[model samples]
Structure formats: C-alpha cells, structure tokens
Target: MNLSPAERRAGITVAIFCIAAAALAFGLTLPLLGLLMERDGWSRSAIGLSSAMAPLAILMVSQFMPRLVARFGAKRVILIAALSDAVLLILLKITDDYYLWLPIRFLMGIAISALFVTSESWINEVTENHNRGRVMAIYNIMLSAGFASGPLILVVVGIEGWAPFAAGAIVMMLASLPMIFAKVADPPFEGTASFSVWRYFLVAPTLAGAMLLFAIVENGSTSLLAVYGVRNGLPEGEAVTLISAVVFGGMVMALPVGWLADRMDRIRLLVMLAFMTTAMAILIPWTIADPVWRLVVLFAWGAAASSIYTVAMALQGERFKGADLVTANAAFGTIYGIGSLAGPLVIGGAMDYDDPHGFAWTIIIICAGFLVFTVIRQSMKRG
Candidate 1:
C-alpha cells in the first residue's frame, strides 16, 4: 500500500483517460435505449426482459470477476468491452427485430458490466486510503457528466435512421484508442469473503433499500420514456428527449449532491429525496400535452433522485471492507437489477388506460413505491 509520486500520477492519469472512453457510451446509450426499444416493437415484457439482463448478468458474472481480472488483466477486459460496445452500437443501428435485440442487449449489458467493474477496480487499487473517497466522488461526477452528455449528442444527431447510433459507436471507438495505448493492468481485488447479500442489506438498510428503489425508478424511467412518448403520439425524436431531459436534470445536481454527501446525514438526505421523488412521479401522469411542464417535472425528479446512487454507495463504503466489500457490491448490483426489471414490467403493464395522459401514472406508481419504502426504512430501528 504505499505508492510513489510517479505511481499516484500514473493511476490518476489512467483513470481519466479510460473513464472518458467509457463515458462516451453513457451519452450514446441514452438515445439508443429508446431507439432500440422502439425499433423492435417491443412489448413492455420484451423491454423489461431485455433490459433486466444487464444487472442479472452483472450478478452472475461479478462472482467470477476477480478470476477474470487475474487472468485477462483489467486493461484487456476494458479494451474488449470498448471494442464490443462499439460493434453493438453499430448492430443496434441496423437491427429492428425484437428477437435480435434481445441477445444484442444482453451482450451490451455484458460490455457495460466489464467497463464499470474494471474502472472501479482499477481506481481502488491505485488510490490511497485518504484519497479513495475523493477519487470515487470524482469518478461518479465523470460518469454523471458523461451520461448527461448522451442526450445532448442525440439532440445534435437528430435521431433518424442510424445517425445517433453511429455517432455513439464512433465515440466509443475514440475513447478506446487512447486507453489501448495506456494498457493498464487490473488493480487488486479488495474483498474475498462470501456473505449473503441479504445480511449486508441489513447492515445499512436505508442506503441499501434506497439503492434498490431508486434503481427501479431510475432505470425504468430511462428505459421506457421513449415508448411512453410514442404511445402518446409525440414525434419519435422528441420522445427520446423525455428520458434525456430527466438524466440531464439529474446531472445538473450531481456535483451539489456529492458535496452534500460529505456534509449531510446521507440517510436523512435520502429520505428527503424519496419524498421529493414521489412528488415528481405523481406529477408525471398529468403532463401529457404540456411539453414545457413535462420537462420541468421530469427534470425535478431527476435532480432529486440522482443523489441516491452516490449516497448509497457511500454507505456501502462505510460498512464493509475486503471480500465483504465486493460481496456487498454484488448484492447491491442484484437489488438494482431486480428493481430495474420490475419497473418497466409494472409500469408498462399498467398502461390499461390508453388516455394520452395516463402515461404519467407510471411515474406516480413508481414514486409511491419509493415513498412506502422510505417510510418503512425510516421507521425501522435496527437494534
């Protein structure tokens, strides 16, 4: 654990260069999420099933990630992820079949898992204990900014044919080239012990519960906003913006939330966010024809909700260490995955009311669920 000046500099450099590459996919993936879902004429079931594969895949694969990192090395896996991500974007642009999209999305999920795990693992290995929190905060900011950028790119590309997808792929390719030159190794895996995910959830129930609830709300929001748009008869391009607006809204507040995370009681902050988010969701269903107001409402929801991820992860960082840490990470990953799968399933299924404004009810239902969870967690006193 001690590092020379040269080593510290090198680690930070690698994180920056590689993270930028990975961030490209974040921006590209935004519009593509809508495009992919719509292109295939996917039922809510199909979108839920396909989208669920990412977190599911993460859970199944993370158990063996240490071994993978040990063998292929982190740099190689990241490069592979980048290359595959580029290819998948190309494939997504060309395909409109539901059947084909399932496998492609699953593979895209794999690529996403690889880059995220590798980026986090690499940083953990290089950073000092004193700096770990700060570095992670920085990384989260980068991811948020990168993710927010995706929608802006879509706005630029104007979302017809393969243009947006192609642009996304190009960004991924560009990110990969510089990292390919750096060729960093996988940082050492921190934890090795196995623990039940349920046990870890108990250790920090508020943070853990918040992670799960927000995952569904956030992922569901991201995945289905476009379809919600199309169902309401908005232009396809405009439909994609609904989701992006929310994400960009979230990004706008990410830095402030990170700053607050250092100052506030994260648990209390999360509880407040739960209330704010629920309010946003309730407003979603009523904004059908009000384009101006829809943006305002979703943006508010995004701003309030974005902090959940950072704070929850901090709770994890506080309570666990070693292999136990990784176990907790995987557990959170599982909860997030399950919630994500359920979001679209529940919302999409509830579309029994075809009224143009009924779409916002989905947000309302999701927000209400978050409210219930918040009350439960806040009221429960862990002895």
Candidate 2:
C-alpha cells in the first residue's frame, strides 16, 4: 500500500499510542490487583481466575472486531475502546467486591481487544512491505518499553491506594485523544467481516502456530517466572528482576531481530530462534542458583522467544492485505487470547506439581514442541 507520508506518520503515532496505553494499563493492573488481593487474603487461584477473565473476553470479542470496524470504522472503535478502558480502570479502583471486579475486568478485555485489533490492522495498512519488519520491530519495542515502564510508575506512585489507578486512567485517556485528531484514514472495510479461526489456520498454519506458542510462552513466563525464581531460592527482589531482565532483552534485541527478518527467510529464522529459546529454557534449571547467570539465560530467552511473534506479525503483512489482513489480525488476537488463557493454567499447574524445576521444564517442553513442529512443517513443505 502506497500511503502518503503524512498518513504513514499519523498511523504510526496512533499505533504507538494504542500499544503504549494497553501496555501501561496491563503493567499497572496485573501486579497492582495481585498485590491488593494478596493483602486482602485472596488465594492465588482466585487471583489467577480473575486475571483469566480478560483473555477469555478477548477470545470472545475479537471474532466480531471486523464487523465492528466494518460498521463503525477503526478510528471510532479505537477511540471508544480507549475511553472505555480509562473508565473501567477508575471503576476497578472504586469497587472492592471480588465478583464486581471480575465482570469489570472482562469488560476491560473487550475494550482492549478492540484497541489491539484496530491498532495492528491500521499499522499493517499503512506500512510499506519492504519496511514492515523494522516498523513492527519498533512497535514491539515501544510495547515492551511501555510494559517495562509500568512497574517503575507503580513504584513512584505506590500501588497501595488510588494513585496507580488514577495514573493508568490518565494515560489511557491521553491515548484516546490522538485518535480523535490523527489524520490517518482507517482502512476501508470491504465485504462482510470474515473471522473464521479455521480459515486463518488454512491460510497460514505456521503463522497460527507461532501466534499460539508465542502467546503461551510469553504469558506463562510473565505470570510465573518470578514465582519460579522464589521457589528455587532466589530473593524476592532478585526474582522480580528476572522478569525485568527478560523485558530488557526484548527491548534491546528488537532492532537486530527485525533486521534479520527483513533480510532472511522468516520461517527459517523462526526455527533458529526456537532452537535458541529451547536451549536457553533448558539452561534455566542449571543456572537458577546464580542470579547473574539465570538473568543471562532469561535475557537470551526473551529475545529469541519474543522475536517469534514479531516475525509472525511481519509475515502476516507479507502474505495478506485489505480485508484479509484485518481478518488475519483478528485471528492472531483470538489465537493469542486462547494461548494466554491456557498458558498460565498449564504452567501454574506444572509448577504446583513439580515445584522449583517445573516452570523450566514446562517452558522447555513448549519451546521444544515449537522447534520440532516447525522443522517438520518446513520439511513437509519442501517435499
């Protein structure tokens, strides 16, 4: 798509705003809620269940996004979603009832899902094919940066009272303002919204697999890695830092990973990264005793694992356009939601059953599965 430079800039701005807002809200809410619930004596299982509702909402809401956009336009959908999210964050702060929080989180998921789909579809629509990888890499970097910044914000504002909630609402409201003023035109929705999960699978099974596995690993690790570290004997502060190391790895490695995708066959690169990630996961059990060494492993692991999603997204743009692109992105979100929904349960179960090493083993198993599947998939294609 040959977009005017002005439109391209506006699209990038909007995309950045959407991702940053989502990441900030996510970063603040997850830890804040968990901490709040823990203080209130809620069980870990209960907290996890409350967290799961959002992804479940995303899974349900994503399928209808194409239709929503078709009827209302991407700009309106995104603006409404962001504003609604800001409102929900404030509501979550006021509500002390656990049952009330669950439904509110579910609604937040729906709103955020709309923002995610529209933002990604918009970015794909505006970017030139040749520059897609790097542009997406930058997007991912901003995303990681936003997530990484959230904890810092929490520390500054303190997570105890209404401060963090107010900050999150303000950030989301700011995110919405750009949608109203950006000159970027929404991608014209053509025909009816086609949101078949199986159809996207048929179009690109490898992309589908990448989306699912990446979400599984990413969500699973983010939710449990610190717990795993603590179980394995690391100090609480150090264990938490492990997650930061991983996020740091993702942010630092973005450009190089994107450069490789732009220059090489993305499938082969994905296979290579999968192997590297698997190797790193296997090393974690051995390295867990040494904080520095374990952080190194996580750093490498984050880079390789996170790159899989980056490349998969770039490939989506390479293979599809127009309405197909919109549908495919919705499919990506749906697949990701499914993975996110299941990842924590699976990994947390394994951790409970096996204790310290279970987390590493679960991740290793998932990474190894991806590596083996990709190799076999490619070999069959060559035949």
Candidate 3:
C-alpha cells in the first residue's frame, strides 16, 4: 500500500480527472435536459421525476460498487462506466420520447455512480490521512470547476440541437483516456462478505447526515436553478449562467475551506457552513431582481454548501481505512443518491406550489433542518 510521493500524485491525478470528467458531463447534461424538457412542454413535476432517475439508479447500485470494483478492478470498471456514459448520452440525443428518457437517464445514473464510487475510493486509498483535507479540497476544486464549465459551455452552444449532447459524450470518452494507461494497481479490497454498507451510517452518523444534506442541496440546485431563473424573468442564456455562478463560487472557496478543515474541529466547521448556506438561501428571494447581487449571494452560498462534502470526505478518510474505507465511500454515494432523488422531487414540488420563490424557501428549510440536527448531535456528544 506504500507508494512513493510521485506515484501517489499520479494516482490522485488520474482518479480526479476521471471523476471530474463525469462531473463535467453531468453538469452539462442535467441543465441541458431540464431546459429541453421545459421547451417541449413537460410539467415541472414530470421533469423533476426525470431528473430523479439518475440518483434513483445511484441509490439502487451504489451499495454494490465496492464489490464491483473489487471484482473488475478500478481502472477497468471506470473505463467501462465511462464508455457506458458516452453511449447513453448519444442515446439521449437520439430519443425524443419522455417515457424512453426515464430508462435512459436511469441507466446513465448507474454508470455515473460507478465512476463516482470507484474514483472517490481510489483517491482516498492513495492519500495519507495527515494531508487528506488539503488533497480532498483540491479534488473538489477540480470537480466544481468541471461543473462550472458545463453551464458555461451550454450558454455558448445554446442547447438547440445535437451539439450539446455530442460535446458531453466527447468529454466522457476523453476523461477515461488517463485511466486506460494508468500504471498504478487498483487498491486491494479487504472487506468481508458479511459487512453491511449501512453500518457505516451508524459509525459516522454526522458524516452520513452531512453527505445527505449536501446531496439534497447540490442536486436540487443544479438540476432546477435554470428553471428557477427562467420563471423569475431571466433570459434563457442568463438562467443557465446562474448554474456556473454557483459552481464557480464552490470552485473559488474550496481551498480555503479545505485548509480550515485540516486545522479546526470539523464538526464546528460544518456548523458554520450550514449557517452560511441557510443565510444565503434567505437572501436569494431578495436578490433575484439584481443580477450582480444574485450571483454574489449564490457564489457565497455555493462555497459554503459545497464545502460540507469536502470536510465530510476528509473526515471519512481520517476515520476509516482499507476495505472499510471503500465500503464507507459506497455508503456515502448511497446516501447522496437518496438525497439526490429526494431533492428535486421536494424542491421541484415546492416550486410548483409556489413558483420561483419556493426554490429559495425549500433550500432554506433543508439547510436549517441540517443545521439543527448537527447542533443537537454535537451537544449530545459533549454531554
């Protein structure tokens, strides 16, 4: 398991590239699909359900990912998943029926979950605990940058034809090239057959909670932010740009937050982030009329909300190792899948009920709930 520093850096770089590529594709696809569906007269609820399919697929498949990687090896599994994603993106471009899209999106979700679970576990496996916070921060920074680039690309391409889909598929295929020639061996899986992924939630309830909260917020915002912007009177181009603004905030602030995670009590850091996120959500309804202020609020909001996952992942690496670590990561993906499924459903429903402002209110409520739960969890532990 001991790798020279250069070897470790190479491993980390390849893994990050793979995951970030997937993020880029997802970032492009989610909003692109949402805007397309909206243009075709799909209901908000129906669009939410369609958006939920990927995470639903993630929830169904994530628990098995560690075992799949163990059997197939990380590089092979990632290669296959990346290929599958490219093919699925092409299928989405060909199909015009919403019913068909349900299954296509679900299948794409499975591929994405595999990419996430395998790459994340691989990165943690190669990292030393002492520097995990900083490394994961850099990991997330790349991830957020990938996400930000997606919406920016969409703004340029205009989501009119096959161009956006073709662009996404090309990125998916290209991202896998690094893995095809990677020299490092896959990390050994030492988890026993009897180990349950759910047990990790009991072992690290706060980490589990943080991940779920993050999933709900991240998926909800990314999938629906464009829709929200349009409903509130922004042009389609401007609406899509809002997504980039949010992700750009996360990209800008991840390093500082990561640095803080390494030096502070992480639980306290999570609390502060939760508070910041809730406050930003409160300001959104007020700021929507002002473009510059809206971006500023969302940028700060994205920074705080996104850091929750960075700190939580760093904590998971600090707390577990080997087979257990892989299993814990699978559990993390599972919880994220669950949150992803619920986020769009709930937030979309709220928006359907109340229009544009519901989006802001739903985020506020979710962040507040997590903030309360985290505070109580900390208090009980101290007692």
Candidate 4:
C-alpha cells in the first residue's frame, strides 16, 4: 500500500482500463446476443433466460472472488478472465445452438464478474482518500463511455456472421495489454478466516443499498426506456436514442460529481442525488412529449442517478481497506446482480399494467424509497 504517487496513478489507470474494456465487451454482447437470438427464432422467454445467466453468474461467483484474488492475485485473475471472455465470445460466434449459448453466457458472466470485482478492488487499494472521489469518478466515466461505445461498434460491424463477435474478442484481448505491460503491483489480499462478503452489507448498508437501487433503476430504464418511448409515441429510432442521452448525461456529469464528493459529505450528496433522481423521474411523464425538454430532463436525471454509484464507490474506499475492501466490492457486485435481475421484471410488469407512465412511476417509487431509507439511516446514526 506504500505506493509512490506516480505508481498509484499507474495502478489506478491500469485497473480502470481493464474494467472499461470489460464494459465495452459487456455493452456489445448484451444487445448482440439478444438480436442474434431473436433473429434465430428464439422465443422472448428464451432470450430473457439467456440474458439472465450473466447476472446469475455474478451472484454465484462473487462470493469466491476475494479468495480468488487472494490466491491468484488480481492481475493474473484479470488476465485469465479477459482471455476467457475472448474465448467465450468466439465460442458464441462458432455455435448457433441456444442450449450452448446459455452456458457460454453463464461462463461469460463469471469472467465479467471477476473483471469487475478485481479491478474495482485494485482501484480502491491504490487510491488515497483525498483523491479517491476524482479517481473513482474517472473510473465511472470510462466505464460508461466504454459501455456506450460498444453499440456504436456493433453498428459499424453489423451483427451478422463472425464480425460482431470478433470485434468483441479483439477488444477483450486488447483490454488486457495495458495490464500485461504495466509495472504495477497487484493489491495485496490476506485471506481472513471469518471473511464474509455478506457481512459487509451490515457494515455498509447505505453503500449496499445505493448499489442495489442504482442497478435496478439503471437496468430497468435501459431495458425499457426505448419501449417506453415507442409507447409514448416517439419514432423507433428516436426512442433508441433516449438511452444515448442518458449515457451522455452520465459521462458529462461524472467529473463534477466527483469534485463534489471530494469537497462535501458523500452521504448527504447521495441523498441529494436520490432527490434529484426522484424529481427527474417525476418529470419524465411531462417531458417525454417534448423532444428537447425530454433530453434535458433525462440528461440531468442521468447525471444525478449515475453519480450515486460513483459516490458510493468513493465512500466504500473511504471506509474499508485491504481484504475488507475487496469483500465489500464483491458484495456490491452481488447486490447489483440481484437488482439487475429484478429490475426488468418489476419495471416491465409495471409498464405492462399501465403503459409508458409505469416506467417513470416505477423509478420514482424506487428512488423515493432510497431517499427515505437514507434519511432514516443518517438520523439514527446522528442520534
């Protein structure tokens, strides 16, 4: 942990690049698989089940991540995971069988989860408290940018044949290059006897809750926003573009939010963000009718909501260290997986029951619920 400033920067940069590359593969594959399955005459149910495998893998694999990192080291595990991802992407392209894809997706999920858990812990280990916020903010920005770029690459390569899969494999392989050459030490992990990732939930309930809520809202909105747009009378193309607006908003606002996290009370900042998210959710119904205003509202809303994860991560680093921090991040990933699985089900059902407005209403309820929980938690702490 006694890294020089230059070494710390290099370490953080390498970790960020690894995750960003993973994110790029993630963003590409999630949509690519769905489109491919749909084209192959798979039922919606089958496609949904195939998609669920990855998050389910995250839930199953997260508990073991800390130990893996402890045993193999972060850098080695990351390189292995990235290589596994590339191989899996190629496998996905080689086989067109739905049964085969289920396991491939599941294994891909395991590799992807490793990349996130290890890289996040790596970032936290190298970062000092004073600059953790800014560094994590940059981390989040690159993550969003990388994820958003995946679809653009898909557009260029097209989803047919091996082109799309090949693009993803190439990126995954390329993502490992920086780590291979970087002169940085892996974060040290001394495995603990009583180390329980679940226990960290009690240790940092707010951080856990923030990650869960963010995952639900983010996944729910991303999966359904275009559907919501179409139901609300927008053209299909423009409806799809709404997601870009949200991503753009997140990318634009990450740094400023990071600056605030460094200067102010992060818990309070989280509360304010929840409030801003709630306000934006409430405004969506009104704004969806106007093209310009819809983008404006979503932009601000995306900025606030996405910053919740950035600030929560900064808080996690502020509060924990070493093996404990890795476990905490593993817990974060587990909670995120649960929320991702739940979000679409809950939000999609709401939309089914009430059309487009259900989309916004569901988000409003979740954000408001988080806001209330945060206030009560902070009050009890102060008392």
Query: What clash count goes with each model?
Result: 6, 0, 0, 0
Question: Residue by residue across 194-258, what tens digits does model 4's lDDT show?
Answer: 44878877788888889999899789879999999999999999998888888788889999999
lDDT of 2: 0.86
State candidate 4's TM-score: 0.97
Answer with 1 or 4, whichever has the higher lDDT. 4
Better-scoring candidate (TM-score), 3 or 4: 4
Best by lDDT: 4
lDDT of 3 by residue, 1-383 (tens): 77899889999999999889898999899889999999999998899789888988989989998788878888889999999999999999898789999999999999998998888888988898778888999999988778767877898888988999999999999988998877866777566634568887787888888898889888888778989999999999998878877878887888899889888887889899989988998998899879899999999988888998899999888877777777888899899988987888799889999987899999999888888888998999999
Give the Cα lDDT of each candidate: 0.68, 0.86, 0.87, 0.90
- The candidate with the higher TM-score, 2 or 4, is 4
Clashing pairs in 3: none
Model 4: lDDT equals 0.90
Error of 1 at 198 (Å): 6.3
- Model 1 segments more than 4 A misplaced: 1-13, 16-20, 26-56, 70-73, 84-104, 121-138, 148-170, 173-186, 194-204, 226-241, 285-294, 353-362, 371-379
**What ranking emerges by lDDT with the best candidate at the front?**
4, 3, 2, 1
Error of 2 at 247 (Å): 1.3
Candidate 3 — worst ten consecutive residues by lDDT sum?
187-196
In candidate 4, residue 154 scores what lDDT? 84
For candidate 1, give the lDDT. Answer: 0.68
